[model samples]
Target: MTRRRRTACILAALGAGVAITQTACGGGTPSAAPSTSYDATVRADSPALYLSLGAGGPKKQKQSAVALKATYHHAPGVTSMPNGDRASLFDGTSQYVEIPDDDRLSVTTTGELTVEAWIRPDALTFAKTDGAGYVNWLGKVSSEEARTEWLARMYSRDNSEARANRISGYVFNEGGGLGAGSYFEDRVRPGEWIHYALVINTREKSDAYPTGYVKVYKNGVLRDQDALDGYDIVPSNTDAPMRIGTAAAKSYFKGAIGKVAVYDSEVPESRLAAHCRAMHGTPREAAGT
Candidate 1:
């Protein structure tokens, strides 16, 4: 049936307290490059979860992962415009979702990790008011210690220079508690299926921190890349479920989320390409009905 409904059904069957893992597809050619694939845990007879945004949403692919508790699609504290259909999760005081519901996946990792998702970004209404648009892709917890690391997420903002240049990408580290660090922008459009990733590699050193990076792919092709070497942030454990819609209460995403995949290791380009090719029609990054 529909993607959301299919996932819901699978979640129902699997029941709570069951730990679902992302595994390799059976009989499928092993990706030449290193990659990790995640599918929802289901009964052998259950259908696949392969739904997307535009059409009836994503469909049920044979391999899909069930979302755990506190995974909110639309909760309170966030506002949705009249024309929008999806609900966002902004804190009552701020316009962002940077913290977890109960601080479940706040562990720090010592090595590399990857983040992926299918997002339809909405208009940046709070850009002017807060000087920061929506950055609900992903985020880490707030650190009280000055030496604590950070792994924030990306979002889009309006460029006053050009009307067509309506969207861009940026990140905030915990160094300044969401105020410090260099904030970059992307020359991309909103309301479409875009693939974005943040890869942290390299070893930590006394002189310099390990090298990390950020990249954006429009419909599968790599459009932007950033080398964030010397920056270090504690990562969540392998068991931590990836946050899709909103990272915290303040930076809730204002759009429809179709699919999300998390790999313990870096995902190969071939697999990413396959996922991009599987994508269907365009989706507006608008609030939900």
Candidate 2:
């Protein structure tokens, strides 16, 4: 069977009354996903890279997008997803997926980009008090060997930046550190599937934000946005691996990562909302679609 012929995600909704519902492949019991698969939304977007955890690996994608097999550290397990599909589960302590970086994976400094995912975090807040009191769930991040580009990070219960359990989208100036950013104010509880997106547009600038702009979204709804002021978000072109469940394999994520997609251009808000609606079992005709 194909890699995508795995277990279905647990979420099943009847209507508005059942706002959130779930099912699981507990005990690692695998189920064959439908032939249509649950990743149609990511595929339809034609991203530079699309990781369908339920579909097995990169080769399973029609584009066969891989120059190397992903390296899984600490062996994150495959488990139930909230979207009626399976996902890669992380342990937060030492579990993550590392992809060899490439130019195709990096966007230009003055370009537009969108990185999105479906995730169910085990904890939105962390115990860490250092490194800005946050952890990177994914990004081309800073490390001793690599300069930073962009990141999708979560704040601790009391971080100096957000001061709450919040999600932040950031773009760095290639020097490999925290740069200009935006964040979502909502508290993300554990075990629930959430659609998270980071959209960056550097071609446009303003007086307050002379560099560009960044947007953060949750469950397809616009949460926050900000201007990039001091620095340009130029990709450092480092050999750092594009990672999930952690940025540089240090700030690990404890949860399940259902799907990941990267677009070279900023994805329109309507499209992101439609994708979110579909995963939520919402009708496609819900205003935007």
Candidate 3:
């Protein structure tokens, strides 16, 4: 069976409370599943991806909950969270995760897309080849020869020349041009976990032809929205890989990344909050620290 079909069957069996058993082939021992109930809950969410970084070795870190294999660049290390969960730490130079380009990841003009993650930065400022700059937490883009498709980045008011600490989201067209974008000027505290989510609804009606709407959510609250401008807000297809912890080596993220999720459809605000609560505990719990 195909991977998607097998995943569906596994979820169905789990929903039905069927006890699953497996036999080792060729006299090899069967691999053990996650031991915690919370892990099971996360797996059942069925995100297009659920990457639990720093929870395991490099090989296992690349394994997605939905079976999509990811690759690590420059070898990020594991770190501990306040809740005892592990997170992958990126060094501002050359650490990030790369997800191979796939058709499912390419957002079209009529498709809905959601990207969410939990991040804790060491510092907002980093030195680049040209000069000092901020970091892009996650994004997908063509090679330097091509334009960026989308990016969720952290920048400063002075455009990284100085540290003002702002978070922004951008959507681009095929030729690597900006389409729709917005930024939140909230100050990001170092070493504190924050939930970030971005939703894109390309089917929404807009005055601009062939463009759609975008929303930025920080910790379950809507922070910004804008209508995409370009005629090709998102290409019908792309072969550019989705990147985490950096975008095309420009702004490498320097911090710990816990959970990363992608949904083919826009997730409800309530549901997004619930997911954050599940992964990071309550806001009250966070404030206590």
Tell me model 2's lDDT, rounded to 2 decimals.
0.65
Score every model by TM-score: 0.48, 0.77, 0.75
Give the Cα error of residue 191 in candidate 2, in Å.
Answer: 1.1
Kindly report which residue stretches of model 3 are placed more than 4 angstroms away from their true locations once superposed.
1-45, 55-66, 129-132, 145-147, 156-163, 206-210, 230-232, 282-289
- Which runs in model 1 stand beyond 4 Å of their true positions? 1-67, 73-110, 124-131, 142-156, 159-190, 203-212, 230-243, 281-289
| Superposed model 2: Cα runs more than 4 Å off | 1-38, 55-63, 66-68, 127-130, 158-162, 206-209, 231-235, 282-289
**Per-residue lDDT for 191 in model 3?**
68
Error of 3 at 116 (Å): 0.4
What are the per-residue Cα lDDT tens digits for candidate 2 across 1-289? 4433321222232233223433221112212232223357667777777776653333322335544446666667786553345678877787777667766556573277899988777776664323878778898864552577787887777677655767788877667654778887665667667788998877767886576788888766677888766455554555666788888666777777867888888887777765665564432223223
**Highest-TM-score candidate:** 2
Residue 250 of model 3, lDDT score: 73
What tens-digit string does per-residue lDDT give for candidate 1 at 1-289? 7966754543333223323211122213212222222222111112212222222212212223333322333332322211122324333232332223222222233343444455445444333221245443444433232322333344444424333323322233444343212233444433333444443432333333334454444444455554444233333333222344434434445544444333434444555555543222111231111
Collision count for each candidate, in order: 39, 6, 1
Predictions ranked by TM-score, top down? 2, 3, 1
lDDT leaderboard ranking: 2, 3, 1
Please estimate how well model 3 matches the true structure, expressed as its whole-model Cα lDDT: 0.64
Top-scoring candidate (lDDT): 2
Cα lDDT, all candidates: 0.35, 0.65, 0.64
